[model samples]
Target chain A: MLIMKNINKIFQTADIQTHALRDFCLQVNEGDFVSVTGPSGSGKTTFLNIAGLLETFSNGEFLLDGEDVGKLNDNGRSRMRNEKIGFIFQGFNLIPDLNLYDNVDVPLRYRGFNAKERKFRIEQNLERVGLASRMKHLPSQLSGGQQQRVAIARALATDPRFLLADEPTGNLDSEMAQSVMSLLEDINQQGTTIIMVTHDAQLAQRAKRTIQVKDGKVSELENISRQHNQAIA
Target chain B: MLETGLILRALARNKIGALLIALQIALTMTIMVNAIFMIQDRQQQMQRKSGLDEKNSFYLTNTVFGQDYNIQAHLQTDLHTIRNTPGVVDAIQINAIPLSSSGWSMALQHEPGEDKDAVGTAIYMVDDHAINSMGLTLVAGANFQPEDVELRKEGQSTWPAKTIITQAFAENLYPDNWQSAVGKTVYISQTQPIQIIGIVAALQAPWNGWNGVERSMLVPFQRESKGSYYFIRTEAGRRDELMPIIEKTLAESDKKRIIRRVTTIEDTRERSYRQHNATNKILTTVVITLTLITGFGIVGLAIFSINRRTKQIGTRRALGATKGQIMRYFMMENFIISTFGIIIGCFGAVALNMWLVNTFNLSPISFQLVAFGVITLFIVGQLAVLYPARKAAMIAPATATRTI
Candidate 1:
C-alpha cells in the first residue's frame, strides 16, 4: 500500500520559487491499478517522483508498505526503492550499452542477489514480457514496443510489490501503447500494485481507478469501469 | 555482486576512450620504470669511493712559465713550504689527480713481447710520500721508502722499479692471491721490470666513466716537468682554508710560474660527473612530467565518459544503485584499464631494457622496479577518476524521467 497526505514540493532557485506540488493527497490499496491523468505543469510528474521515492517531498506524511518514507535517509530510500518499488520510464530507459538480459539484471544486482538467483529472475521476467528469445539483443536493436517490454521486464526483475510508470507508452505508436497497457493490466491482475501517470484519456480509462490532478492536487477519483459494470448488472 | 562484468562489457562496446587512456598509462610505466632505473644506476656510480681523502684534499695546476726554472729545486722548495704549513698534513708533486678525467695510462704485460696480451691501468707519478699524501692504506706491504724515490724529466720514457697498486688492480693482476703480488716483478712499458711493493685498499682511475676505473697504481717518480699538479692533503675541515694560502704561496714564491686552476678534490669530482648529474636531473623531470600528464589524461577521459553517460547513471540511480556503488563502478573500471595497461607496459619495459642492454651496455632492470611502476600507475588511475565518479554519483534519479 502507498499513502500520501497533504504532500508538498517546492523548487527554489536564486530568483524564483516554483510550487510544483501543493497539498497533494493520494492513497492506493494493495493490488490496485491507479492511473493519474493531468495536463502539463499540473504537478503529475512531481507527484509520481515523490510517490516513487525518487525525490523527497517538501513536507508531508508519506507511508509506503507501513514505513515512514519521509523519515528515511537517502541510502534507506535507495534500499526501499530497490526492494519495494519498480520503475518503467517513457524512454524505455534500458542502458544502451547493455543487452536486454543485462539491462534486466541491473536492479537485481543492486538488490544483492546472487548470480544464480539473478539469472533465474531475469529469465523469468524477460519470458513474462515475451522478450526471452531476444534477451541477448540490445535495446537499440528492438522495436519501440519490444523495448518497452524489455523495460517492463527490467522493472519486474526484482519482484517489487509496487510499480511506478511515467508515460510508459509516450514514445510508442497507438498499437504498441495498447499492447503495453495490456501488459500492465496483466501485471496488476497478478497482484502487483501499479501507479501510471499519463495524459491519454483512453489509456487512463483502462485502469481500475482513475484520478485527475489539477493545480497540484488530485481533483477527482472515478472508478469508471466498475460503475459501468455495475450499471450493466 | 559487483558490476564489474557489466562495466567490462560496456567498455568493450565503447573502447576508444578507455583504450587511449590505457595506452597512455602503458607508455608512462615503460618510461618511468626505465628512467628510475637509470637514475639509480647513476647514483650508484656517483657513490663509488675514489680511495683518496677526497674531503680534505686539494690540487692545483702549478704551470711554470719561467725560463730555466729549476723544476727539481722548486719542487723541493714548494713541498717544504707546503709541508711546513700549519694545517697541511702532507704534499706531493704528481703527474695527475684521480677522477680529473685527464691522466696517463699504460699496459702491463705478463710477458714482455709484442704478441703478449696485457692489462691496462692508470698511472700516477709521485714520490715516496705518495701513500701518506694521498691517504692510501698499505694493506699488504710497506710504503715507498725515501731511497726508492726517483726523478723523471719531461718526455723521458724510463720507468720506476717499485710501485704500489690498488686492491682492484691487484685482483686483476694476481687473481690467485693479491697478497702474493707484493715483491713480485711485473713488466711495464714493454720490458722494464717493476715490483709491486704494496697494495692499497682502493684507488680509482682518473676517468670515473671508464670500465676499469678502479684499476690504478702509484709509480714513485716525481715529475720534474714544466707543468704538474701539486697534490696536497690537509687536516679535516682545513682543505678550503689552506687552498687559497697554498695557491698564493706558490704564485708569489718566484713570479716565474703562474699557478692557476686551484681546485678541491670534491669540486673536481663534481666537474668530473657533471654530465651524469645533469642527465639524472633531466630523467627525473621526465618521469614526473610524464606521470602527471598521464594522470591528467585519465581525468580528462573519465570526465568525458561520465558526461556522456549522465542519463545512464541517472537511470542506474533510479533503479536503486547507491552512490557508493556508482563510485565503485568507475573506480573498478579504472582498475581494469590500468591492469591491462600495466600488462602491456611490463613487456614494453622489458623490451626497452633489452634494447638498452644491447645498445648502451646497461644492466637489465629489476623486477621490483617494474612492479613499482604497475602499482604507481594504478594509484594514479584510481585517484584521477575519483572526482568524476563522485560527480556522476550526485546526479538526481529524477533525471531519468526527464525527456532529455
Candidate 2:
C-alpha cells in the first residue's frame, strides 16, 4: 500500500552538500512485512523517516494508500501521520513522567478520540501486548522490553494502517528481542503493514521480504521463501 | 483538562522552581494592590476643592524691615494702589491666605467658661471686602457690615463680635444641624462671646491633611502689623498677567518692607501637597519596577523549563502532537503556576492590607482591586510564557525525535 519512485534527499551545509538518499525506489503491497537492512549512514533511517512523513525529500513521488505524500503541507503531513501511520523508535520513547496508560493514550489524544474511545483502545492494545495489568506503572519502573511493548501499544492505539519501526529491539536482550519480533509478526499477520529496519541478518530473515540499502541506494531485494527454495535447489 | 493534569505532574517534578516563581508572583500582587490603592487615595486627597477662585487670585506677602515704618498707613496705601490697578477685581489684607499652610487656630465653646470639650477651628481675620475677594459664597445670614468691621491693634487677644463660620465648622459646634449654629453665640478661649452671623458653603483650610480641614471661620478685622498678607483677585484669565504689576506696585509703595513672596493660590496649594504628591510618585515607580521584575522572573523560569523538558516535548511531537498543541501545553503550565500564586497572593494581599489599615489607618483593599491584580497577573504570565512556548513549538519533529 506504499510506493516511492526515484526519491532524492539532500542535506546541505555552509560549504558542503551530502546526499542522504538518491534515486531510491521501493514498493510494498498491503499486509506485507518488509525489513530494511543497511550499515551505518547508509540512508536506511532517512528512507524510513521520509516514508513515515516525518521528513521531506528534495525530489520524489511517494504514494501511500493511493495519495500523493509529496503535495501535503506540514499540518497535512502531521494529520496523515497521526491517522494512518504509527512509529516505533529504537529508544522506546515513552514519556517518562506519564504512567503506562497515559503513555499509550498519547496518539489517541492527538487523534482527537473521545475519552471513552481512547480508554477502550488503550486497554485493548495494552492487553494485546500483555501489559494491561501494569497500566498504572510508569515507564521508569518497567524493563526495556516492557517499555517497548508500551510504545507498541501507543502506536496501535490510533489503529494506524502502516507501521514504521526503526530498530525496535535494539536495546533488548536476545529473549526480549525474540518476543518483540514475534509480537510484530503477529501484528503483521493481523493485516497491519509493517516495515522494520534492522542490522541483524537473522531478524531481517524473519520478514517475508528484505531490502538491502547501500550508498544511498537500494542494493538488493529478496523474498525469504524464494531464497530458501533457491538455496535448496 | 488532561493537559492540565500532565502539567501538574511535570511541575511536581520541579517543585522548587515552581514554588519560587509562585512566591515571586505573590509578592508582586501584594505590592501592586497596596501601591495602587495608596496612589488613588492620595489623588483623591489632592483633588479636594479649595473654596476660592484659585485660578484668578494671587497673594503678596510682605514683612516690615524698617523699625520706623508706619505699618497701617503703608498697608492702606498699598491696598489702595493695588485696588486701583488695571484688571484688579478686589483686594483685602489678611493674616494668611487659604491653603498657605500658615494660619491661626483657636478652640470654640458655646458659652464663656463652659466645661465641655472645646471644638478646634481655623481662624481667619479679614475685612468686609474679604468675603467677595476670596470668592467665598455666603449661604446664610450676610457678609460683615461696615459697622461690624473692627481694627485689631497689636497685642489684642479678643476677636470681633460677628463672625462667619463654614458649614463644616458649624456642624462641629451644633452636630444636630449646622443651620442652628447661625445666630448662636460661641466663645473663643473664654473671651467675649461672638455671634455666628453667617455660614459659608465650604472652605478648606491651609493644612488640608488634618481631619478637620473644612472646619474654618472668618472674622471682620483689619489685621495691620509687621507681617501682612494682601490677597488680590484679578479679572477672569488676568491673574498671571497682573502678578508682576502687583509686585512692582507693592515694592514701590513701601521700600522699607520686603515682598517676601508673590504667587497664585494654586501654587500655594501645590506646595502644600508636595509631600503627598512625592509619595504617590515614589509608590508608582515602585509598582512598575516590581511588575517588570516579576515578568522577567516568569520568563526566565519558562525558558529553563522548556530547556529541561525538550526531550519530553520531542516525544510528544513525534506521537502526533501538532505544533499548536505543544505551544498550548507550555502555556497551560504557566497558567497553572500563575493561578496558584494568585490564589496565595489574594490571602497575602488581604493580610497586608489589614496590617496597613491597623498600623497606618489606610483604606482596606477592595474586591475589584483584587480581581484587577489577578487578571493583570494572568496576562503577564501569558505574555512572558509566549516566547519560549513559540520556540518550543518551532522545533522540528524529525530532528527532535532523533535525540534517542
Candidate 3:
C-alpha cells in the first residue's frame, strides 16, 4: 500500500551537514507486514517518518495509496497522515490528561466523525485490543501491557490504511513484548499493513518481510515465510 | 464540536496558569473601567452650562494712559465710538463683570420686617446700559434707567439709584420664594438701605460656577466707578469687523491707552474648557499605555501557558481542534476572567464614587454606564489573548510527542 523510490534525507546543523538517508528505497503491498531492523542512527526512523508523511525527504518520490505525496503542502500532508496512517510508539505516547476512551477517540475526532460514530469505533477498537472493560481508566492506572493495548486501540480507532510502529515493544517486559507482538500479528491477519522498526531479531522474524537497514541504506530485504523452515531447523 | 471534557481536563492540568490568565484579564478590566470614567467626566465638563449668553458678547480692558486718572470721560467716549462702529450691537461699562475671578464687594443683609439687618453679599456696579449690553433678563421688576445712575458735575444733584437683586441672594432670607424677595429691602451697609427694584437670574462665566458663594447684587457705578471694564455686544457674526474700529477709536484719542485683552465670549469659554481637555488628553495617553501593557502581559502569559501545556495542546490539536477552536478556548477563559473582574470593578467604582462624592463633593457615578464599560473591557481582553491562542494552535505534533 506504500512505495518509495530513491528517497534522500539530510539534516543540517550550524557547522555540519548530515545525510540521514541516502538513496533509500522500499516497497510494501496491501496487507503486507514489514519490519525494518537496524542499529542506532541507521536512518530507520527517518524512513518510517517519510513513509508516514510526518517528515519530508530532500529528494525522492513517495506514492501513498497511489497518490504522489511530494506535491502536497504541510496541511495536505497532515490530512493524509490523519486519514491513512496510524502510529504506535514504544513509550505509548498517550495523553496523560485523558482516559483510554478519549485517548482512542482523539484521532477519530480529527477525521470529522460524529460523536456517536466515534464512540462506536472507539468501543470496537478497545474491545478488539482486549481493553473494552477498562476504556474509562486512565493510562497511568493501567499496567504496561494494558497501556500498550490502549495505545494500539487508539491507533486502530481511526481505521487507518497502514500502521507505523517504531519499537512498539521497546519499553515493555519480555512477556508484555511477546503479547504486543502477537497482537500485531493478529492485526496484520485482518489486512492492515504494518511497518515496524525493531531491534529484536526474534520479534523481527515474525513479520512477513524483514528489511535490514545499515549506514542510511537498506542492506537486505528477506522473505520471512521462505526462511521459516530454516528457523524451525 | 470539540469534546468539552478534553478542554476541562487540559485546563485543570495547570490551575495556577489558568488563574494567572484570569488575574491579568481582571487587572485590564479595572484599568479600562477607570479610564472610561475619566472620559465621561471630561465629556460632562464640556457640556456644563455657563449662566450667560456669551456667544455674541466681547469684553475689553482699557490700559491706556495711567491707572490713577478718572476714566469716566474716556469710557464715555469709547462707549459712544464703539456704538457708532459698524456691526456694533450695544456697549456698556460696568465696575465688575459676573464670574470674574477678582472683584470688590460689600457685605449685605436681609431683614424679616421692620429691621434693616442683612448678611454679606457680593455687590456689582453697572451702568443703565449694562442691562441691555449684557442681555440680562429680569425675572421681576424694571431695568435700571440711565438717568438713575448718570453722574453730575460739581454742584450738581446726585442720581437716584435702583438696586437689582440676584436670584441666589433672593433665595436666601426669603427661602423658596425668589420672586417675593424682589420688593424686599436690603442694605449694603447698616445705614444705606437700598430698595430692591428688580431681581435678576444668577450669571456665571465658565469657571466661576464652582465658587461656593452665588449671591450677587447690581448697583449704579457713578463717580466711584474706578478700574471698571467695558462689555460690548457685537452683531451675530461681526465681532472681527467691530474690533478694528474700537482699536482705531482708542488709538486716536489716547494712543498710549491701548485696548488690551480684547476677546470674544467664545475665546473665554474655550480658555475655560482647555484645562479639562488637557486633563482628558493626559488620561487618554495613560489609558493607551495601560492597554498596551495589558496586551503585552496577556500575550506573554498566554505563550507561557501554551508552552507549559504543550502536550495538552498537541493532544487537542491531534484530536481535530481547528485553530478557531483553540482561539475560542483561550477567549472563553479571558471572558470569564473579565466578567469576574467587571463585577468586582463595578463595586470598586461605586465605592470610589461614594468616596469622591463625600470628600470632594463630585457628581454621582452611573452604574449602568460602568457596566457597559466593563463589558467592553472584556472584549479588549479577548483581543489580547487571540494572538497567543493562534500560536498555541500551530504547535507541531512532533514537538508535542517528544519528551520535554
Candidate 4:
C-alpha cells in the first residue's frame, strides 16, 4: 500500500519559486488500479514523481508499505524502489543502444538477482508481453506499440508490488493505447497496485478510481468501478 | 561484474570514441616509458663518483710562455712551496683531472704482441703523493714509494715499470680475481711491461661518457714539460679559502709561466655532465606534457559520453540504480576502455623499447618499470573520469519523464 498526506513540493530557482505539489493526499491499496488525470503543468507528473521517489518533496508525509518514506536515506529509498516499486515512462525510456534483453536486465541487475533468476524473469515477462521472439532486437527496431510492451515487460521483470507509469500509452495510437491499457489491466489483476498518470478520459474510466490534479492540488472524480462493486455487495 | 559485459556491448556499438582514446593512451605509454628510461640512464651516468677529494681539491694549469727558465727546478720549487704552506694536505703534478673530458688512454694486454685483445684504461701521471692528494683508497696493494717516482720528459714513448690501477681496471685485466692483479704484469703500449703495484677501490676516467669510465691507472711520473697542472688537496674547510691563495702564490713564484684555469673538481664534474642534465630535463618535460594531455583527453571523452547519455543514466537511476552505482557505471566503462588501452600500450611500449634498444644500444627496459607504467596510466584514466562520473550520478531521475 502507498499513502501520502499533505505532500508539498516547491522547486526553487535563483529568481522564481514554483509550487509543483501542495497538500497532495493520496492512498493506493493493494490490487487497486488508479489513474491520475490533469492538464499540462497541473502537478500530475509531479505526483507520480513523488510517489515513485524519483524526486523529494519540500515537506510531506509519505508512507510506502507502512514504512515512512521521509525517514529513509538515499540508499534506503533506492533499495525500496528496487525491491518494491517499478516505473514506466511515456517515451518508453528504453536505452537505445541496448537490445530488448539487456534493457530488461537493467533493473534485475540492480535488484541483485542471480543470472539464472534474472534470465527466467526476463524471458517470462517478455513472453507475457508477447515479445519473447524479439528479445534480441533494439528498441528502434520495434514499432510504437511494441516498444511500450517492452517497457511494460521491463517494469514487471522485478515482480514489483507497486508500479508507477507516467503516460504509458501517450505516444501510441488509439488501438495501441487500448492494447497497452488491456495489458496494464491484466497486470493489476495479478495483485499488483498501479498508479498511472494520463489525460485520456476513456483510459481514466477503466481504473477502479480516478483523481484530477489542478494547480498543484488533487480532487477525487467519480469512481465507477468502486461504485459498481459496492452496489453488487 | 555484470556491468562489464553490458558496458562492453554498449561500447562495441559506439567504438569510435573509445578507440581513439585507447590509441592516445597507447602512444602516450610508448613515449612515456622510453623517455623515463633514457632519463634514468643519463642520471646513472651522472651519479658516478670520480674518486677525488672533489670538495677539498682544485687544479690549475701552468703554461710557460717565456724562455731561459729552468722548468724542472721551478716545478719542484712550486710543489715544495704549495705543499709546505698552511692547511695543505699534499700536492702533485697530475697529467689530467678525472671527469675533465680531456685525457690520455692506453691499451694493455697480457703479452707483448699487438695481435692480442687489450683492455683500455685512462692514464694518470702522478708521484708518491698521488694516493693522498687524490684521496683514493688503496683497496689491495700499497701506494707508490718515493724511490719509484721517475722524471718523464716531453714526447717520451716509454712508461714507468710500476703502476697503480683501479679495481675496475684490475678486474678487466684479471677477471678471475682482482686481488691477484696486485703483482700481475700487464704490457702497455703493446710491449712495455707495466706491473700493477696497487689497486684502488674506484677512480673514474676523465671521459664520463666512456663505457669503461671507472677504469684508471696511476703511474709514478714527474713530468718535465712546457705546460703542466698542479693538483693540490687542502685540509678540511680550507679548499675554498686556499684556491685563490695557491693560484696567487704559483703566479708570483714563476714569472716565466702563467697560472690559468684554476678549477675545482666539482665544477669540472658539473660541466662534464651538463649535456646529460639538459637532456634529462627535456625528457622530463616531455613525459609531464604527454601525461597531462592524455589525462585531459580522458576527461573530455568522459564528459562528452555522459552528456550524450543523460537520459539513459536518469532512467537507470529511476529503475533503482543508486548514486554510487551510477558513478560506478561510468567508472567501469572507463576501466574497460583503459584495459584495452593498457593492453595495446604494453605491446606498444615493448615495441618502442625494442626499437630504442636496437637504435641507441641501450639495455632492454625493465619489467618492473613497465608494470609501473600500467599502474600509473590506470590511475590517470580513473582520476580523469571521476568528475564526469559524479556529474552523471547527480543527474535527476525525473529527467526520464521529460519530453524535451
Best by DockQ: 1
Model 4: per-residue lDDT, tens digit, A1-233?
89999999999999999999988888888989999999999999999988998888889899999999999888888888888888989999998888999999999999888999999999999999999999999999999999999999999999999999999989999999999999999999998999999989878878888889998988666566755855787
Which ten residues in a row are the worst by lDDT in model 2 chain A?
A223-232
**Per-residue lDDT of candidate 4, residues B39-132 (tens digit):** 9889888887788889999999989988887878988899999999899999999898899999999888999997998999999999999999
**Tens-digit lDDT string for candidate 1 (A1-233):** 89899999999999999888889888899998999999999999999899888899999899999999999988898899899989999998889999999999999999999999999999999999998999999889999999999999999988889999999989999999999999999999999999999999888888889999998989988866644745777
lDDT of 3 by residue, B1-404 (tens): 45455656655655675566556555555556665676787677566544455777887777645666566676777788887777777887755555555565555666434355665556656667766677677888777877777663334333234688667777775787778876666655455567788887764422343543466677775543434467888878777777667766776777546667777767776776677778788878877787677667767877877777686665454434555666677777666655655676666766766776688666777766677767666767788888888887677655433435
Q: What tens digits encode model 3's per-residue C-alpha lDDT throughout A157-179?
A: 88888988878888899999999
Per-prediction DockQ, in order?
0.80, 0.47, 0.24, 0.67
lDDT, residue A175, model 4: 97
Q: How far in Å is the alpha carbon of B319 misplaced in model 3?
A: 5.6
> Which parts of model 1 have CA positions greater than 4 angstroms off?
A225-233
User: iRMS for all predictions?
Assistant: 0.8, 2.2, 3.3, 1.2
Cα displacement (angstroms), candidate 4, residue A43, comes to 1.0
| Reference-based lDDT, each prediction | 0.91, 0.87, 0.73, 0.91
In the predicted model 1, the residue pairs found to clash are: none
Cα lDDT for residue B152, model 3?
Answer: 34
TM-score per candidate for chain A alone? 0.96, 0.96, 0.96, 0.95
Q: In terms of TM-score, which candidate is strongest?
A: 1
Which structure is stronger by TM-score: 1 or 3? 1
